[model samples]
Target: MALGSLGLVAGALLIAASSRWLPGELPSYPPAQNAAEARPAASLAIHDARPGQPARRIAEDLIAPPPLDVAGVERIEPRPPLGELGLASPPQTPMPQDWRETLLYRPVATSSAIFEAMGRRVVISGTIDVDPDRTCAFGDAVWPCGQRARAAFNAWLRGRALKCVLPPDVDRFGVAAPCMLGKQDVGAWLVGNGWAMASPSGIYGKAEAAARGAEMGIFGPPQ
Candidate 1:
């Protein structure tokens, strides 16, 4: 071999000799004589000697408390099919006592109601504007005004009976005359509650004034 090749071989032999791994690079450890000791050292350090046992598996209670009286516990009976009693029923829109003399009203799921009076079936004249889809600044976030109004109205009207007084005449569109719930006018209530604004004709001037003053309904009051 060339002189350079011989020098390289000698240098490598010197390194291997110093490390004591010269002739043959043997296994890291001696082979186990039995199968029981064949587990890797890493596994032995991380877990108990018991093979296949979980680390979190507890064998006994560390502190025992007084026994509970489970034997005397009352048995639960089968549930009846009557459904949830806590849930209230939906509202049934009031029907007119007399078709010719009264106005039948069915809410259109909104401030407006379906009206049938004076031999005509038509929608009531909505003298108010409720911006249900309008998003306004409320605290740190904006929220839908219409949804809140609808939910509040439905929750209040549901399960409770409502009475109204209707005028004896019909409007130009065959719509029923304006109605009122007690002394509280329907249009006035809607406006006064903040769900609606006063009509262009200012039909609910006082109601609108009250609602704006109190910051009610879909109108998020100024901060």
Candidate 2:
């Protein structure tokens, strides 16, 4: 029995010695041991070890701005109500009414006539005024369109009454206003006849376009 035990012990010792020489897994270490192995002793000494400061992880060491507190921040003041500013609303002007008046014999221009009652020159609205000395092109030839336009206007007027939308009090200087010859709008007639252009107000744009398309009066051969 003693000899058998001695042989078993010898066999165990042999097995241990052979296992140590064989391939095996490498030993593992804790995180503190790993950091100590990676860094130099001088680099580790530079870190602060002051009291009251807790050791920080990589995530905690990152820079981060403080969160904003909207409720605690100062706010801008709002503007006061318009009524409390002591301002008054602007006054509106009433529209002028139509008035009937007789003309002083003839029209001064294709788009203007003299009112006999007020002796004030009223330019027909919606028509651009053409100087009496102005000329126009007709197939490479120029003609006195302005004079012809005025003559045509004079013939149409023939000392007749005009219905105008003018103020009751006459203007010291001339003013442009809508006028009617019987039931016809004088401005529309002038623009439609191609004797005058439509004003920038676009009131007679269609009429001017029609006359231009048809090549009538000044837009065509002189009448």
Most lDDT-accurate candidate: 2
lDDT of 2 by residue, 107-210 (tens): 44433232333466788766786677888898878999888887788777787777776766564767667778879988889889887888766477777888
lDDT of 1 by residue, 123-183 (tens): 3234554445656665676777766665665554443323334444445444433555445
Alpha carbon lDDT of each predicted model: 0.54, 0.69
* Candidate whose TM-score is highest: 2
TM-score each candidate.
0.39, 0.51
- Which parts of model 2 have CA positions greater than 4 angstroms off? 1-94, 97-118
The C-alpha RMSD of each candidate to the native structure, in angstroms, is 20.4, 17.7
* True-vs-predicted CA distance for residue 202, candidate 1, Å: 3.3
Question: 100 in model 1: Cα distance from truth in Å?
Answer: 6.1
State the number of backbone clashes in model 2.
0
